[model samples]
Every structure is written in C-alpha cells, then in structure tokens.
Target: MTKTFKTLDDFLGTHFIYTYDNGWEYEWYAKNDHTVDYRIHGGMVAGRWVKDQEANIVMLTEGIYKVAWTEPTGTDVALDFLPNENKVNGTIFFPKWVQDHPEITVTFQNDHIDLMEASREKYATYPKLVVPEFAHITYTGDAGQNNEDVIAEAPYKGLPDDIRNGQYFDQNYHRINK
Candidate 1:
C-alpha cells in the first residue's frame, strides 16, 4: 500500500527504525562514566532528550533527510554549514527524484526538517531510507503491529516513558509539525 505521511513524526514512527544513537551513548558514558561532570547519554534540547553524534548532540529524522553531528551549544557551526552564497546550491541532499523535480525541496536543520513539495503535496513519494544507528523498528504485520511492538524490538527497549507521550509520530508514521 502507498504511504501517506502528513508530518515528519508520522514518517519516522512508521517507516524509520530508531535507537538511542549508540555512539552518543558511548560519548555520554565517556563524559560521565565516573566523573564529576556527568550527564545523561542523550542531550537536552527544548527540554527533550534527543540523540546526538560525536561532535554534535542532535539527530533529527524527517521523511527523506537525516542529519547527524549537529551542535546544540548555541554555536554558529551549524550556520556555517548552511548555504550562504546560493539558494539553489545550499541543500545537503538532492535525491534523484528531487534533482529531476527542481520545485521540490527538503531541508534538514538542527531543530526540524522541512519539505516543500511545490504543488504536489499529497502525491510526492518520499525516500525510504533508514539510518544505520536506528534500524530495529519494523512497520508491518497484522493486529499486533503497534508502537509498542516497534519499541520492544528496538535496541534500547527502555526509553523514557515521557518521550512517548509528546509530539511523537503516528501509526501512519509521519510528523506534520514541530
């Protein structure tokens, strides 16, 4: 069946399998394993414990775009990576379909991922790629196929309960807003 994801949350929840970003977990342990400067494995952004990377502390997943090594310290490093010289040349990725369809654009930023589908909002087919770090989730099967099933199969089955209550993806697996 063709998928219809209205938001990024819906997309990630249904299509992408996500974990705690093991690299970040190692980093968190390295920084706080046995020291006074101990912090949790996940970093806090906007009061949420989002995943991180080696030099970055945020990993956001949208429909077709995924980003790692994002800095969360209010620094301009992320800005430096953005396109300043050319609007048409600043994007990090241009899937083969997007390249042929110039009007469609999906921009992945530190906080959110935005997809502008030109005039084909409902019909655009998003990329079906999964980040290696988070590939345990499965979106298939019959009656038992729910969020719980996906989470249980995840590498880290014990994610904080609060994380599930807020603006999480839906069964359809897409997020519409931040």
Candidate 2:
C-alpha cells in the first residue's frame, strides 16, 4: 500500500527545521502541531499551523506551497517541490530593509533538509558576509525518533569559523528540539 497526504491532518503533529542559504544564515522552527479550519481558496488551502505569534498564511497547491507572514518580521516564501522527489526549488522575497532576495533550492528526506542558494551575484557588495550558500539541517522528534538521541548522533558540528571568516561552503545546522 502507498501513503498519500490529502489533507493538513496528515501533517499535523509534525515538526521540522527550515534553514536558509542566504549570506545572513538563519534557521526556522516549524511545527504542524496545531489544528485549525483551513480556508479553501480555489486550488489552495490557507491557514496557520506553525506555532508563531505572527499572522501567517500558508497556501498549498499541487506540488507547490507559499507561506507569508507579518509580525516579528515579514517574509514571503514560495516552494515548488519536485515530483516524487524530496527536492524543492524556491525563492525568498524579503521586504525592503532586509536585503535583496535570492533563489534557493532544497532537498529533504526523513528528518533532514539541505538548502543551497542558486544566485550568488545578488550579494556582490557584501562579499565578506558568510551566508550558508548551502545549509544542511535535521528535524528530530518525528516518527517516534528521540530528539536527544538524534542530536547526539547528528553528523554536522558547529558552524566553522572559516565559514564565518569569509570562506563559503555548505553549512550545517544542528538538530534543534521542539
């Protein structure tokens, strides 16, 4: 038998870590730990599931998703997942005052996600900034996995100083507990 997720309920109680590959490297904690009445808009469903105080809206389409929020910070993100593959191509557009947005690609499987920036020229001026041109992160505490055990056995260590000191490479973010 094959498994299919046709509704938000399928993802409820799931937790995952989201990482960005831009020079100002950052990671987001995502948890589908809430239940809400999702508003259906045409071919998309919009609602909030992540445990954040900001007003957020998530739109889901076939193989694509868009999540936008306003509060502590404002951001507009769109992700297009590849067919049958744990890979996605996306872009992040920040409001003015943040920085120029860049195209990003991501791949995920089980409890891990890897992100890479597709455009480097966008930050030509801030050359010394260490952005995770590539970032790898893990999502623990899912599917009966122990968060502590996962963190202890995680492959990547702390961010290298070279990466912060101007050297650029794929960076790794340790698994964070929810």
Candidate 3:
C-alpha cells in the first residue's frame, strides 16, 4: 500500500535548494500565495518569484504525483513526484535546441539532485560534455550569503579549474526556512 496526497497544498510551506546545470544555485520556497520564490546569489541577493503559476498536480499512481506547468517561454515541463521517498523525476525539454537533444532527465532526491545530461549520441556535440560527467545539486544553508562562500564550500570545490568553470551543472544551494 502507498500513501497519497490530496492536493498540492501538501507541498506548501516547504523549502528546497535548486541547483542549475551550470553550477548556479538558488534557494526555493513554496509559499501560500501559490508562488515559488527563488533566492539567487549571483547578481541578485533578494528572493524573487521564479514561478507564479499554480502547479497542476495529478495523481499518477499510489504515492506518485505528476506536477506540471508551462514556462514563460511556452515550454511545458513536468515532474513525477514520489513524496514518500522525497524524490522527483523530470525531463527538461529545450524546444529551441537540437530536436534530437531536446530533453534531459533529472532526478531530485532528499539531499541531492542529479543534473547530468541524458546519454545520447546526438548530444555528442553538446558543450557540457567537456566537463565532468556526473553533476549533482546538493543542499546547503539559507540564502543571502556571498557567492564566494557558497563556492568555497561546495562539493565541487576540489574539481579541476577547467571543469569547475566549465558547463558542468554541479552546485550547492540553500533551503529557506519553513
């Protein structure tokens, strides 16, 4: 038997750390306002609305939910959520890029998220391949800290200079207070 959540409300008030594929990181929060806020550390030090739309949560199976939304760029994204395991699986579709290499699967776990590019011979020319193969996003502290501090303490801190500065997406992000 598996547990099921009645609504997206179950995820409200939760905080998470999101790490992009390019090593950029941000703190994420699901607010009561139905908006997802992001605390960026690069150029902006403030929390802003990265997603304001209401997420469409559909129960796919027992203990499994499908959350989806459309981006401002008209791209539709969806994630399969397994609340019991605190995990999410999703594929990011890049409509404007090479059609064959449009989708990349990402796995988000309790402590980390895998952001490696999907294996495909068609993506052989992708620039990110030059960097370390396995990229992961790990949880850190709160936002508002200096970028230097974040980078210094990241798991990738010991990576080669070229790989660190390369197109790798490995990063550490902070989680906001609930």
Candidate 4:
C-alpha cells in the first residue's frame, strides 16, 4: 500500500545543524518522514555517535513541522522545526540515571543553519517508498580527543539572535541543572 503524509513530505531531503543555548550541538538529516539521522556534536552528554530512530513527523502548519522520537535510552525528544522562522523548539526527556545526576529534563530554543533544503514538489510524488536499512557509524579509537581542533572550529559560535529573540508558546520551560 502507498501512504503519503504531509508531515513526512515536508521533511524529506533536508539537512541542518543547530545548537542549544546550553551548548549542545546536533546535526540532523531527514532520511525519510519515519526517521532522521542525527549526530551529537557535543554537550552535557557528548558522543561521537550517529543514531537514527523511528520518528513521527507532523506538519503543525505551513513551514512548521513537528518531529518526535524516543531514544534507545528511553529518553523522549520532541522538536518543532520552524525553518521559515529560523528557530526550533524542543524538549528532551532524559531517562533517569543516564545523565550522571538527578536532573531530568530541559526545553529550549535554538537557531538552525540550513545546509540543504528541498521540497516534495521537486521530486516525483510517492505514496510510500521502500525504507532503507539500519545505519552504521564508524569511529577511530582516539578520534574524539584527537579531533579537538576540528571541534573548536565548529560552525557555531553561539546561538543566533533570531532564535534567542524568537517568541515561544512554552513559556513554562525553565533551565535545570544537568
């Protein structure tokens, strides 16, 4: 059977990177509506891992997409992509005992640097395409520490002002200790 979802349609074939106010940077690739390939640049729970999860994408409105997924560690992540508005709204539900402390969660806004963007209209429409296999990520034993120079040259200097100045619906979000 063929299935076409507006949410998924809006996200396919896009790549971008964003950094949280708290210094967390992530790169995301829209492999399909059902999943996203993501890599954590660094932060509280830094890692040199690329992970893809079965994600749910929904178009909340024109040019606004909501993507959510649960990680293997049982942490839940929900994010709103407002590319037209140049910002993202998200919350991370940290699994207990995994973060090395008693802290639990955080919600934040950040600006995105769009690496590539494409529309479903540009490609032939498909009801449902055969999804790809699980991803494989390779890493060298000493790459993490040895890559400090490259990390310092990361594209982000700080959270962009547009994101810092954007209005948010979730005003109840507060910064918590990690």
Candidate 5:
C-alpha cells in the first residue's frame, strides 16, 4: 500500500503508540497540529504523569515522518513514525544536566505556595543551566498493537489521591515489614 502522509495534519485527533525495541512503550495522542499528549507506561512516571508538549513534525516520505518535542524537563525526544509498517525510529536526547545534577528532584514545597496539596508544576526551588552537551539515545521500535490507547486526560491524571495528597511516600512496594 502507498503511504500518503504529507503532514501531521494527516493524523490530527489520532492516537498512536510506539512499542520500542528497548522494552519501553509510550502512547501518543495528537490533539492538533502542534500539540500531543504522551503517556509513559513504565518507570518513575509510569501511569502517573503525563504531559502535553508542543511538537514539531516533518515529513521524509509518503509513509515516514519525524515528530520531535522537548519535554518540560528538558529532555528532547524525536521519533520517526512509520505508520504503514507499524514501526518507529526513536531517539531520546538527554542534556548533560540530567547526569551532571542527580540531586535535583521533586520538592513539594519551595515552588507552589498557591496549591493546597502539591505543586502542579516542577519544583523550581533550584534551577540549573544545561550545557550544550547532549547524548543521543537511539532505538528501533514497533507500533502498538492498536491505536485504542487510554489517553491521560490531564497532567499526572493517573496519580493516586494518596500520593497527590502527600500523606506519605508511595513506598509500599519498597518497604518491607520489619
């Protein structure tokens, strides 16, 4: 079959998933030509946090195109979407700041004084200047089995009320009964 992808507009309001070969999977829902919501299926933010990012897309051929976006945390990710073959070429570019500053983490306070429970935004108590150095993380991946993915309605939409309330750390899985 001939692929006729000319621009991101071709897939507006569409949901797609990338099942990366590296054992990771992510869901992407294109809200429009410039915005997309992605959900991470694993790791610290898995099923807990989701972000809508401004995306930049480009077409390389009929069925192939690249979609790139800068996450709020400064991680740059680019994915070459091959819709017809259910394939994707993905690259996650990490700035040196991620490795150079390991101490930076989520601070409930020092950032959000208005919110009653926790800061809805990144705890900006301490900000760093990232150098131009970057590491290119490349991976070849397959598409999701289907496009009927569960979309995160909002940022951190999957967060539990207990965690969002900060009654305690969600460490039930880590703490052993002693």
Candidate 6:
C-alpha cells in the first residue's frame, strides 16, 4: 500500500534521512511523462529537475522538500506522488485528466529523510526500480550521537586530499582512493 498526501504541508511534514557514501543523485517519473532530478544537498532537499537543469525544483506537493545532513536532524518528512512541472514555485502543473490518476506513494524510513518510487503503470510507461528499504548514509554529526556515525562520517569525508583538489560536489568529500 502507498501513502496519499492531500496537501504540501503533509508532504514536507514527513521526515526521513538519506545515507549515501558519496551522496548520489536520482531521477523520478510519474504516471504522466513528467520527471524529476535530485542531488544530495546538505541541509536541503538536494537534486534537480530532469527536464530542465536550470530550474531548481524544490518540493513536490507540499513543502515536503528533500534535505541532506551529516547528522540526523531528528525531524520527520513525508513523501508523495505528485504531477507538477519541476520548478522552484512548488505548484501543481498537471492537466485536468491527471487529477483522476496519481501514482505517487508516501513512505517513511527509520534513517532516511526521503525516498521515491518511480511510477509503474501500463499506459503511462514509467520505469520501476526497487527502492532499497535499508540505506547506508554518511554525514557529519555529533560524534557522541550514535554508533552509526563511525561508518557514516568515514566514507562521507574519506575522499583523499589529492583527488579532491580539482572539482567536487560537497565540502565533506574526501577521496579515499589515490
């Protein structure tokens, strides 16, 4: 079963955290031919719109925006299936026909701030991939917080200094391999 969101406030109100060794990115699709791109940005919903790169699409239905942190914020966020142009405005951009059929699901993970389920439909023709239930996250948090910090902060800031010289995504990136 999937969770349904009636408003944007309900979406952003949900809380989950992302665990990434190198802070990866993802692409999402809905019943319509709409797509969204996201990147792991620390302390904020990290990612971009798949259709247009310049457009900084933040939230889906509500302010249920995506956020990444080195440590868990102890806040809960929601997830939902929405049909809107990936933009900063955070408004619904769908035709009258789409209102009848929505394919987004809202899920909460023990350690994740957010996760997405690509639409799996017959006519809309979207790709379906199994979103992992357990995710490994790396972020900088209070060392005294939990036992998980060992693994999270290690790889998160493990990239070696030499490899980090040219260009990188986040300040925590530490190239472990030479």
Regions of candidate 4 where Cα sits further than 4 Å from its true position: 1-8, 101-178
Which stretches of model 6 miss by more than 4 angstroms? Answer: 1-38, 41-127, 140-178
At residue 115, candidate 5 shows an lDDT of 40
RMSD of each: 19.2, 14.6, 13.4, 18.3, 11.8, 17.1
Clashes of each: 13, 1, 1, 0, 0, 28
Find the candidate with the highest lDDT and give its number: 5
Query: Once model 4 is optimally superposed onto the true structure by TM-score, how far is the C-alpha of residue 3 displaced, in angstroms?
Result: 25
The runs of at least 3 residues in candidate 2 whose Cα sits more than 4 Å from the true structure, single-residue gaps closed, are 1-4, 18-65, 79-84, 100-178
Which lDDT tens digits does candidate 1 get at residues 40-89?
Answer: 22322112122222332222322232222322221111101111111110
Error of model 6, residue 123, in angstroms: 8.3
Angstrom error of the Cα, residue 169, model 5: value is 32
Using Cα atoms with residue i matched to residue i, what is each candidate's TM-score against the true structure? 0.20, 0.34, 0.38, 0.51, 0.52, 0.18
Q: Which ten residues in a row have the lowest lDDT in candidate 5?
A: 134-143
True-structure lDDT of candidate 2: 0.27
Q: Highest TM-score: which candidate?
A: 5
TM-score of 4: 0.51
- Candidate 1, which ten residues in sequence have the lowest lDDT sum? 82-91
Better model by TM-score: candidate 5 vs candidate 6: 5
Give the candidate order by descending TM-score.
Answer: 5, 4, 3, 2, 1, 6
Q: How big is the positional error of residue 23 in model 6, measured in Å on the Cα after superposition?
A: 7.6
Give the alpha-carbon lDDT of every model.
0.24, 0.27, 0.37, 0.44, 0.46, 0.25
